[model samples]
Structure formats: C-alpha cells, structure tokens
Target: MNDFFSTTILIATVASGIRLATPFLLASLGEALGQRSGVLNLGVDGVMLMGAFVAYFVVLKTGNPLIGAAAGILLGMVFGLVYAFITVNLHAEQGVSGIGIYLFGLGMSDLLFQKLVGTPLPIMPFPEIHIPLLADIPIIGPMLFTHSLIVYVAFLLVPAFTLLLNSTTYGMNIRAVGENPAAVDSLGVSVTKVRYSAIIIGNGLAGLAGAALAIELGIFQHNLTNSMGFIAIALVYFGAWRPFGVMAGSLIFGMVAAIVLQGKTLGIIPRSASDLAAMAPAVITIFALVLVANRFKQPAALSKPYERGR
Candidate 1:
C-alpha cells in the first residue's frame, strides 16, 4: 500500500509539472518556428509581455477570453511585422534591433498597464476540457487529456510544426531562405517575403503563448512573463532548432520549475534551494547551446546585413 501510494504521488507530481510547463512549451515552439526560418528573434520577451497585458485587459473589459486571445495574436502580428520590416527588409542587425524591440515592449507594456489598470487587474481563467472518452481512463487519461485547450494546442504543435518543416513547399522556402537567402533570391523566391512571413507567424504564435499565460493563470501583473521570453529563446538553441526538440526541452524546463516550487511548498526541499533549482533550466540551456553550437551550422545570412547593389 505504501509503495502504491508513493507511485501515485510521483505520477501526480509529474502531471503537475507538465501543466506548469505548458506556457513555455508554447512560447518555445513559436520561437523554434522563427529560428528554423533563419530569423533569430530575441524580442520574444517583449512580444510576450505585450500579449499578457493585452489579453488581461481585453478579458477584463469584454468578459471574453477568446477575444482577448485574438487581440493578443493580432498585436503580436503587428509587432512581428515591425521586427521583419527592420531586420529582414532593411537588413538591420537582428540582435541589436531585437534588443531595441525588447526595451520598447518592456516600457510600453508597463506604462500601458499602469495607465489603464493601475497596480494589477483580475483575469478570467480558461475552462479545462476533458475528452469524453479519454477523460474516463484510469491514470493516464486524467494526466494527459484533461487540460485547457491551450495545453492540447501546445502538444499538437509538436507534430504539426514537424510536419510543416519537413513535408511542405513553404517549409522548403523557409529552409532555403534561412540556409542561403542569396541563393533563394537568385531563384526569385523573394528572400525578404519568406523571412517576413516566418517572423510574423512566429511572433503571432508567441502572442497566443502570452495570452495563454495570462488567461490560464487568472491574473495580471507587470512583467508577468518573468523572463520567460529569454528562457524560450534559450530553448530554441537548446532544442537544436527542432520543433519536437523544443517541446521536449520546454517540458523539461516547465517540469523543473513546477517541481522546485512544489517541493518548496511541501517542505520536501529547502526553500532556499528552490531558487537555485529554478535556475536549472537556464543553466542546462547554456550547456545545451554550447553543444549545439559545436555541432550545428547556423544560417548563412543570419544576423548579417543585406544590401542590394554596389
């Protein structure tokens, strides 16, 4: 009886871990999509911040989480267009421009939130949908299938993005632009257009990730993402620029964060140790990036300024 109970508790703990990890998984998946197309968007943090605030306000005012989510994605698309215009079209330095966008997002989001909602605002939570058939299963069903729509979407994106990158003509264009924009340009594929499309799609998905965080959590606070954007960025490299890998990596990160917090609450681990453990994902990400960098080749024109004629 004791062993059985222990096993049950362990499984529950892991389920909780995955639940917490869902947001990062979504954000990382979005980032992975952009990176695969050769545009490294360091502005994910800004986009996330904007998404969170927009979703929260829209939900509070309209009492419709769906509208809020849509607003989030739309705003993200607008932001992505800006990023693409500067980086892909004008050939700005991707890294530097990304930093500028981050700063702008940070200040703008904070200011907007304070001006409108003041200190903080209450938010509506999403309903969990349990599959009628699968929800009845013993342990596995409850652990996996009974979750918010966003959770299901995050997992679905793993296979979905994988198929997108491997099986479609658009995927071919993405790879071509990322791998060699000049070559694609010579082919008359419009290197700028492809890159722009990737950035917009990537950032728009990132917006949904932000909205999911705010709506799922049921509240809004300034800088709510808590550097989650950076973690998502790190995940892109850690996952070696692969969709499925990003999902796995995000899960590991999310699980670690959930476990650390829970362990602290349950007194299973020292409270002081919780902070260190929370750093595990970022630390592991650095190590993973080192390994990936050694073995992988980055896109040829990535971060390189593009110019037309002499």
Candidate 2:
C-alpha cells in the first residue's frame, strides 16, 4: 500500500486515467450533440464495435493509422445515415430502431471478423506526442502533456463543443429543436435536417472513439469495447448534456479505472477481489447517472419523432 503512494505510481496512474478517458470523451461528446438535436442513439456501442474492427483491419493491411481512423469515421457516418433515415425520416421509435442498429452492428462486425480473419493478430497503435514545454514540467508534464494525439483531441473537443452549443446559430437550432421542435419548425427551421446532421456527426465521433480504442490498444478482439459505448450514453446524462460536464464525468470514470488497475498491479487489490475491483467504474457510472437524472432534466423532445404537423 505504501508503494502505491509513491510518486512514480501516482504519476503513471494519472496519465493512464487521462488516456483511458479518450474514447469515453469522444463518444459522449457525440451523443451530447445528438441528444441536443432531439435524437437518441442507443446503438453507439454497435457503431463503436464496427469502427474498432474496420480500423483494426485497415491498419493491419495498410500500416497507416490515419487511414484506418478515417475508415472508422466513414463507417460510423454510414451507420448514422441509416439511423437517421429510420428515426428522422420514417418516424420509427428511436429506442427500438437504435436497438436494431446495435444488434446489426454487433452481429455483423463479429461475423466479418470470423470469416475474414480467423486468428487475432496484433497491430501498431498510435504513437505518443510529447508537448514541447509542457512535457518538461514537473509531475504535471508526464501526467497530462505526453500522450497519443487522440487524447489531446478528446480534451480539446470539450471547449470546441461548448462554443458550438452555446454561441453558434446551428447550435441554437439544435437546442431549440430538442426543446421544442414545433417552435423551431414554426421559425422555418427544419427539424429533420437538424436531427439528421446531429445524428451523423454523433455516430462519426462514436466511430472515432472505437478507432482510438483499437489503435491505442494495438489489438482487436470480439466485443473489443466491452460495452464502453453504453457507458458513453450514460455519460451523456451524467454531464447534463453539457460538454464540460461530460469531460468531468469521463475523467472521473477514467481515473477510477486507472486507480483500480494501479492497485491491482501494486498488490493493493487482492486477486480474489479483482473482479469486484473491476466493477468500480461501472458502479460509479450508475451512481453518477442517478444523481444527474435527479438534478438535471433531459430535453423535452428526446426520443420523440418530430413531424412538421400532426
């Protein structure tokens, strides 16, 4: 236990926490955008699985992480389009359609993997970038400034999304649509267009999250995400649909995960209770969700299909 408190272990734990937060940050940000436009996509996990496999396979073949990441984003957008068509155009029940998409993504990704690559093979992950001056700072440097490019991108997005949702015209339209589609429609805004745009972008981010995960880990497996996507959805609520709030939630979950992992490695956590220790993050998520649900109200139009008129 004393060894666990040493500076080296502490710094490593913090850094790992930040790294682990990347996918959660990316996925939750995307979900926040979709929710703000009155669309709920519960299939984020499925989209993530599809993205993870595509990114892995692409990198395996091309040896380029960039191309693999792009392919993942594109595949996610394709799924987003289908989801938009079902929920936005066809007026299907958002929850049911989302579940269908999830099932499809889950089954299809595994099927493709089994048929195409019978054995799991390792791939190169994204390389880390150390910020010049920042990386040299005491303690804080290694804990925050040295990491894969995706980690920085994930954090930067918090402020970018905050600006987009609070200051931009399109952002206003999204918020309005989520709150009152009828009002936005009366003002000549097309709710369908807004919702569609939000969904595609959201799903694309979800894909990127998956790609980041696979690339960060340098390997792929069946159910690589292990339901991380669903946790991202929960994070949307945990953040009260706010970008910065989402970042906080992601960090909390990430840090908890890091702590658990560190404790296990240091023997502070016994092997017998390792499974229970692994459950800490999920338990925290559920607790956070409950608190947020009670304190913050979701968008009024969430999960409801909007038609211009009755």
Candidate 3:
C-alpha cells in the first residue's frame, strides 16, 4: 500500500490507464451514436473481433498501422451496412439479429485466422506520438500526452461527438429520430436513413476500436475483444447515454484495470487469483450501473424498429 503511494508508480499507473481506455472510449462513443439514433447494436463485440482480425492481418502484411486502422474501419462499415439493413430496413428483431451478428463475427474471425495464419505471429503496433512540450510536464503530462495516434484521436472524438449530438443539424436529426421517429418522419426526415447512417458510424468506430486494440497489443487470437464490446455497451448506459459520461466510464474501467494489473505485478494480489483480480473492473462497472440504472433515460425509441408507414 505504501509503495503504491509513490509518485512515479502512481503516474505510471495513470498513464497506463489512459492507454487502456482508448478501445473502450472509441467503442462506447460509437454505440452512443447508434443509441442516440434509436438503434441498439449489441453486436459491437463481434464487430470489434472482426475489426481486430482485419487490422491485424493488414498490419501483418503491410507493416503500416495507418493502413491497418483504415482496413478495420472499412471492414466494420461494410458489416454495419448489413446490420443496418436487417434492423432498420427489413425490421428484423434487433436483439436477435445482433446476437446472430455476434456469433457470426466470433466464428468467422476465428475461422479466417486459422485458415490464413495457423500459427500466431507478432506484428508492429501503432507508434507513440508525443506532444513536444506537454509530454515533459509533471504527472499530468505523461498521463495525458505521450500516446499513440489512435489514443489522441479517441479522446478528441469525445468533444467532436458531443458537439455533433448537441449542436449539429445531423445531430438533431438523430436525436429526433431516436426520441420520436414519427415526428421526424412527419417533418420529412427519413427515419431509416438516419438510423442506417448511425449504425454505420457506430460499427465503423467499433471496428476502429478493435483495430486499435490489436495494434496496441501487437497480437491477436480468438475472442481478442474478450467481451470488451459488451463492456462498451454497458458504458453507454453507465454514461447515461452522454459522450462525456461515456468517456468517464471508460476511464474508470481503464484505471481500475490498470490498478488490478499493477496489483498482480506488485504481488499485492496472489498470482493464483490474477484471473479473479481481472474481473474487478467489469464487476465495478456493473455495480456502478446498477446504482444509477433508474436515474438516467435512454433514447425513447431504442431497440424498436421504425417504419414510416407503421
């Protein structure tokens, strides 16, 4: 406990926490976008898995992180189109469709990996980009500055997304569609179009999130996301469906996870219990959500298919 109080160790832990939070922040922001447009995509996990594999394969072949990230986003956007088609256009059961997507991604990613690269191989990840003067500042510097391009991009997106939801025309359309599709439809806005766009954006972000995760880790395997996608969905609720809230939720999870890992390393937690220790962040998130479950409201039409005629 005393050792944990040291300034250097604390800063390192916080820096690591920020790094760990990137994937969650990206995925949660994407989901928040979809939910705001009245779409609930529970298959974000599957999307992430697919994105991770795609990014990994791209980086393995090209040795370029930028191309890998783009590939992930592209692959995810294509799948997002399928998800939007089923739920938004065809009016399939959103929940069931999402589960099917999840299963498909899970199986397909593993299958492709096995067939393409039977043995796991190492790959280059994103290179860290440090802000010149800011990185040299005291504790806050490293925790906030020195990080990969995706990390900065992920955090920057919070404000950009918040502005999009709160101040932009498209943002208003999304909120209007989510809260009252009939009203939006009556006003000449296409409900399906808005929802489709939202879904694509969400899935694209999820893909980027997966790609970032795989690139940062420099490796991939079955279930690489390890249910982090579900955790991102929970973050939407935990954030009360707001971008800043979602960011906060992600940071909390990241910090807790970093702490847990630090504990294992410091021998504060027995090696035998490391697995259980890892559950701490998710458990904490669940408990936090439970406490505030009734306090926040989600988009009114979330999970309900919208048909202009019906």
Superior by lDDT: candidate 1 or candidate 2: 2
Cα lDDT tens digits, model 3, 182-234, are: 99999998888899899999999999999999999999999999999999999
Residues 117-202, candidate 1: write the lDDT tens digits.
Answer: 99675777788899899977888777787888878887998898888888998888887777777777787887777778888988
lDDT of 2 by residue, 124-178 (tens): 8999999999999999998999898889988999999999999999999999999
Ordered by lDDT, highest first, the candidates read 3, 2, 1
Task: Provide C-alpha RMSD values for all models, in order.
Answer: 2.2, 1.0, 1.2
Number of clashing pairs per prediction, in order = 0, 0, 0
TM-score of each model, in listed order? 0.92, 0.98, 0.97
Q: Global lDDT of each model?
A: 0.80, 0.92, 0.92
lDDT of 1: 0.80
In terms of TM-score, the best-performing candidate is 2
Model 2 stretches with alpha carbons more than 4 Å out: none
Alpha-carbon lDDT of model 2: 0.92
Candidate 3: where are CA atoms >4 Å away? 270-276
